[model samples]
Target chain A: MLDYSALRTVAAVIQTGSFEKAAGLLNVTPSAVSQRVKLIEERLGIVLIVRGSPCTATETGEWLCRHLENVGMLEEELLKQLPTLAAPDEARQRVTLHIATNADSLATWFLTAVANFTKQSHHLVNVAIDDEDHTAEWLQRGRVLAAVTSLEKPIQGCRHLSLGALRYRATASPDFMARHFPDGVTADALVSAPSLLFNQKDRLQARWIRQIIGRELAGPVHWLPSTQSFVDASLAGMGWGMNPELLVGEHLKAGRLVELRTQTPLDIPLYWQMNRLAADRLADLTREVVQTARLLLRHEGR
Target chain B: MLDYSALRTVAAVIQTGSFEKAAGLLNVTPSAVSQRVKLIEERLGIVLIVRGSPCTATETGEWLCRHLENVGMLEEELLKQLPTLAAPDEARQRVTLHIATNADSLATWFLTAVANFTKQSHHLVNVAIDDEDHTAEWLQRGRVLAAVTSLEKPIQGCRHLSLGALRYRATASPDFMARHFPDGVTADALVSAPSLLFNQKDRLQARWIRQIIGRELAGPVHWLPSTQSFVDASLAGMGWGMNPELLVGEHLKAGRLVELRTQTPLDIPLYWQMNRLAADRLADLTREVVQTARLLLRHEGR
Candidate 1:
């Protein structure tokens, strides 16, 4: 069996981002924290935490953190079954579940799912946002127990469930379309029109552009990273972007924004991936994600 | 003179994240793009692009990007004065200016400032998010040309303008107040109540708690990263948090939310810091940010 106390020390160091802070939290000396870290590294024969001002866990350390997460789940279940075991100061028993998700989903329907779960459960959460295509990497690295991802196939030692596709409409304010596509959205016109890109990782615009225009063009772009601000920028005639239908449905109906193309929407299929060990234990979260996504995301690929 | 062709090549690689994509954008062969990158790195004797599937810039590379930004500003100025010099396909000439700001500022009043700026200016922006106390580091590292920071002192070689304090109220939903602080808030009651945190970098709750009750206690925390979600979680009775006054004013007025303590609020002073070279050229942005922040943020640090 692993030393649970030392493992928690490792978790504390990563959480607080320093040996001194971790030691303070654990009510131990900094040297004691360092000694435990060094001993664990020797036992595992791998460096766990990278020594820095704000310390970070290495891949091996992340695996250990995942182990502790599983242990936390077991403890939570055990205490549920035997109420007498819980300390009177049981508020401290609440363990934070780290989950990864894309920003667009968070803005649209993801929070509703989690909010309902947190309402009933003793669980709290740490939500880390990355691009849809990349959230799986967070799960693979053991940085997060589960993720909303683009990968339909489960990563090794993980369970996969389809969460349906998030549909996007290539939209712009009417003024912008009239000014830039007066002669229609031809390849030449697209080459000169401005686009709104979320970041380098965001490829919804690039994918939609290729799907519509059938080729790649280096268009000028405004990189605005917020989902709400992305819609706001498009509405303000800054650039054209692939706005999630949920975010712009009202604007589109009111004719404040117009789609670049009629009857063609990009559907990005999403999946929920979770560590196999934690799947049954975190069943509530999985259910909330799947049920919410089913109700909200586009089920038909078209 | 510095090799601008090589510099643009560097920018393309970082923006596109690979040599092949950079080559495609520049209408050059992959080998030619590679050659230009190598020549520039050798001439400067520093690694500009960190070779990866998605190439990233080193600190030195960021400084070079900042240089390119200044040049783009100058060229934009020149083209405006001499309209005939601008090519018909000048949409490609739109340059992305990078700025860093705190999440609260973005959610509250910063976007309004930039929104108005974009309505008139030809410039597009890439906004980076960080904790207010840490945003100045983005300017210091040359990753961003300007930032909304909590630092009253300007970073070296940058202009600083005070942009007032953002006031925060320590608040909870009526349900939460009734459940957790039925007998009125005290240190003992707070020790058992769950609290919402923006992230580890967010110290507002901890600071507020220290001020109100006058001691530190290890309370359970829910780490919700979104500015909007933070307020939503509070409304849902998930936990108490220090929410910005701008975001919670309506809730307070409607009595949906109540302060954890009345009459005491934490005020975070903000400032705008920009690269000296870009300061004069990007005057409109500085003006918009300062003006908007002045109108929105709390003038007196109460």
Candidate 2:
């Protein structure tokens, strides 16, 4: 068992990539961070960091760091939701409904919903997106009040409503399409193309291709885990990708990206699930999500 | 936003049927429970329950009670796994793995898997069951480190493996078969019979019936939520049910209960999934599950 405070300090140091940076972020001296980390390693009975000029989280350290980050995020979210649980000075009386959502939505329709909450007294937003499937899990853990999920059934103790569908189009940059799919967007050519994915969890484009070709295709695909980079990778002609129409719509109309598949557009119907408590604030947030979903994704089609 | 402590006290009072009994269960005095409930009602801005010699959770109180119980159970598991975080006692040197599992599996194969973990001294087990699908949500929330899920795909950051098939024989007492399936044990008769579900979430019987008859065609059925009661209900001539062979094998052998749909024995394959970092532990556990799954479920095939 590692000392939590020490492990947290080590994690901060690793995340910031420097004890000094971690110390500043923690509002403590650099020596404090170093000492905490050293103490954590001693308690763990394992060397958690390779200490030198620049700190690196060891394999064990990274594991602990990830768990720490996960638990810390949830605990922070719990604190945000439970005002009475907090100290009097730290009390956040406003009911904040945290939701996990994609970056494109965050940049677009999601903010519109956030603005809708500004008229109300209290709200907080923490945007996180890597895999859509796990969003409902966020709701289950009480990390979020509600989530935009891909699943139909609501998690236990929650009620869900279908928001709408998000249509995804497989598009590639003109230059990349020319270089890779020069023979046209034929089944044979797609097999050899260097496609890109948002992350390892993404299989939309691959699933689409399998549906089209009636077989699975393999390629040495690049993984740009960041939202901005994933879209940029598509624009840079590095790979073909199934991107949300909203993200690539402008580029497609400008002829920067060619539609790889025109017939079978993936319509990912989204759902919003929340704890069924008839709280005024949670209800308001759900209404905002429904309104935003109707405007942004309703027209995308099923 | 609900006062959980108040809700829990009310529920304890109902379960025990007395303030003193509830207080003893909670390791608090009757006065303390009374004071807490009063504070909760004052804080919640609602009347929760009618205080008397024996207590009962109100409609709203019951709802909050359920949620509070869920939260408390999850937190207890969390405390057990993170003993260091929960308490100041113990050296806090080992990583504990919490797992959510159904009562039956926990009583049987799940424990066998734990017995195999004796060599690897890096983990502890926290077992609870909400539902199979919801179990992964527990893992997602970090309430549990792993789960035996019906889901084929891995939860985010988790890896999955097949645990082979668990064949369920739709069985009932001879009297039940005679009364419900008077025409015979044909697809049509089975559809019209009072079918038993393990719970609301348990769809094995429905799925089994649907494979033959299509849609819901069953008679008015009783939902016995407990696994043991579900089996007992069928045995008591309540309904036709899809019972695990392990649970009812002896009765079937003794010719006490008769199996229906012999040709279409409902086979539900189990899958084991866990966080990837616990590879060694998962490896040990998976090996045991495969071994136990072989011994427990393998022999029941038609």
Candidate 3:
């Protein structure tokens, strides 16, 4: 069995990007930190860290880090089940749980779920902001324990929980619509109008165009990568864009943004993809996420 | 010669992530957009775009986009040389230039350079914010035409120019330092104290620990990903951190932040890396970036 304390030291080093920082985190001497790492390396017969300006884990080191993180979560679950086993003076360990999520969900309803979880548990949340289409990459790389993704299929060694659908509306400032498409959103008018994009990877605009206009779209495109900035740009009449209903609902209702008429709103289904660990904390987190998502998002079947 | 118009159509589609959007951009019907794409595919006898929710360019498509962008730059240069060749009714096309840069640079002195360039040239600047260590990935993927990186070595098909050094100081709020280390920074005190980090990838804290304490550091770490937030967290007494001289210079002088005495400040050398394109616009941009960097950053080899 691996030494949990040594594994923790190794993880701290990688996370903090230095032996000294890891030593400081573990409340151990620099020599102690070094000794622990050396002991592990000697046992494994392989180099673990590539020391430089900031230290990075080798391939084997990455695997070890992942294992340590998983084991830490399991240990926390064990502590919850058998409170008698916990030493009186031993403080409850705060497991660092890394999660990958999209900007829209983060901006809209995800934070509430996170806030609820943190209030109930002693855990550090490390969130990696990414597009829903791409969050799986973090899980695949073992960079995150869980992710909010658009993909329904589970990654190997992971399970999927369907959250719900996030509805989006193609919207623009009233002044923008008047200036760009004075008559109506026809083929010719669209050619001259500028549109807002979240990023190059964002397909919502294109998908919406196909669904609404039933044609290829052409226009000047402004790429605003940040969610808040994208919304602000849309409000400032930079261009029309697809805005999540939760984010822009108030703006749409208050006449700050005008929704372009379409046959149906674009609904993107989101899923919680997590490692298949039977940890209570993970289960509790999943429950909170599902409950919060259901309260905020449209039912998937609908 | 390849049809430049069709090539532009293809690029717009890829950028906008939809055929309909590309058609809208080209001021053509959806069928026209489809025909242009089909024509290009037939001419090349290879697929260019992989149709999906958001269309992505195939290997051939990426090459074509690069060619078209280069050709567009050359055309602009030609127009500049021979004003008589310019059509009276044809508006000047705004070239899009993608640049990858570190977050610190983007948050500090880079925007001034961009603003200056935009004032003089009709070009749309797309800035991709990444760590200095990782900016080359964007260049390798052809996602960016230029990059601001710390790597001294040039990537294949690219050239590198030394920008300057960005000095960093180990600092914390006065209250934080007193609370954490009542006495001077000893190894035992440092281990128990909390530190603020920019992100998991950030190594400035670790580097500072090694330089200042000459040993491994141990501490509770708070990861704040945003540059502004990282500074705010430090100011809020969350933890000590390595603050950029440019960003925290005023704070240090104003007594808001106390500098931890070390042997010397950490100086990180930066470089401007770009494709070896002979476009005048590219030349102009490089000149502006180099000039601006020299003004803000410490001149290297001085």
Q: What's the lDDT for residue B257 in model 2?
A: 85
Tens-digit lDDT string for candidate 3 (B1-302): 88877888888778877787676666778789889998998998999999885788998998888777667777777887898895543334556677888877765676667646644666666777788888987887787889999888988888888999888888878987888778867777776666766676776776777777786554656554556545655676666778778888899889998876643578889999898764345887888899999999987466
Give all candidates' CA lDDT scores: 0.85, 0.63, 0.76
Q: Where does model 2 sit among the CAPRI classes?
A: incorrect
Poorly placed runs, candidate 2 (over 4 Å): A1-97, A118-121, A277-280, A299-302, B1-302
RMSD values for the candidates in order, in angstroms, are 3.6, 30.2, 7.0
Candidate 3 reaches a DockQ of 0.20
What is the per-residue lDDT of model 1 for residues A7-91, given as tens digits with 9 covering 90 to 100?
8889888877778878866778999999999998898789999987468889888789878876787887777788888455432
State the displacement of the C-alpha of residue A301, model 2, in Å, after optimal TM-score superposition: 6.4
Model 1 residue B275 CA deviation in Å: 1.8
lDDT of 2 by residue, A1-302 (tens): 54667776886666445777678556689898888877767867899877753467788886676566445545555776885685552232222234666544553455566545533423333344435666787777665657777878878988888888777888888877777788786776875576766543465765787678775454435444444444655775656888878777899899988788665677777787776652333677778788888888855433
User: Which has the higher lDDT value, candidate number 1 or candidate number 3?
Assistant: 1
The worst-scoring run of ten residues by lDDT in candidate 1 chain B lies at B86-95
Better of 2 and 3 by lDDT: 3
Q: How many backbone clashes does candidate 2 have?
A: 3
For every candidate, how close is chain A to the native chain A in TM-score?
0.86, 0.68, 0.86
**Interface RMSD after interface superposition, each candidate:** 2.6, 28.6, 4.6
Q: Model 1, stretches more than 4 Å misplaced?
A: A1-3, A13-66, A78-92, B18-20, B29-55, B58-63, B74-92
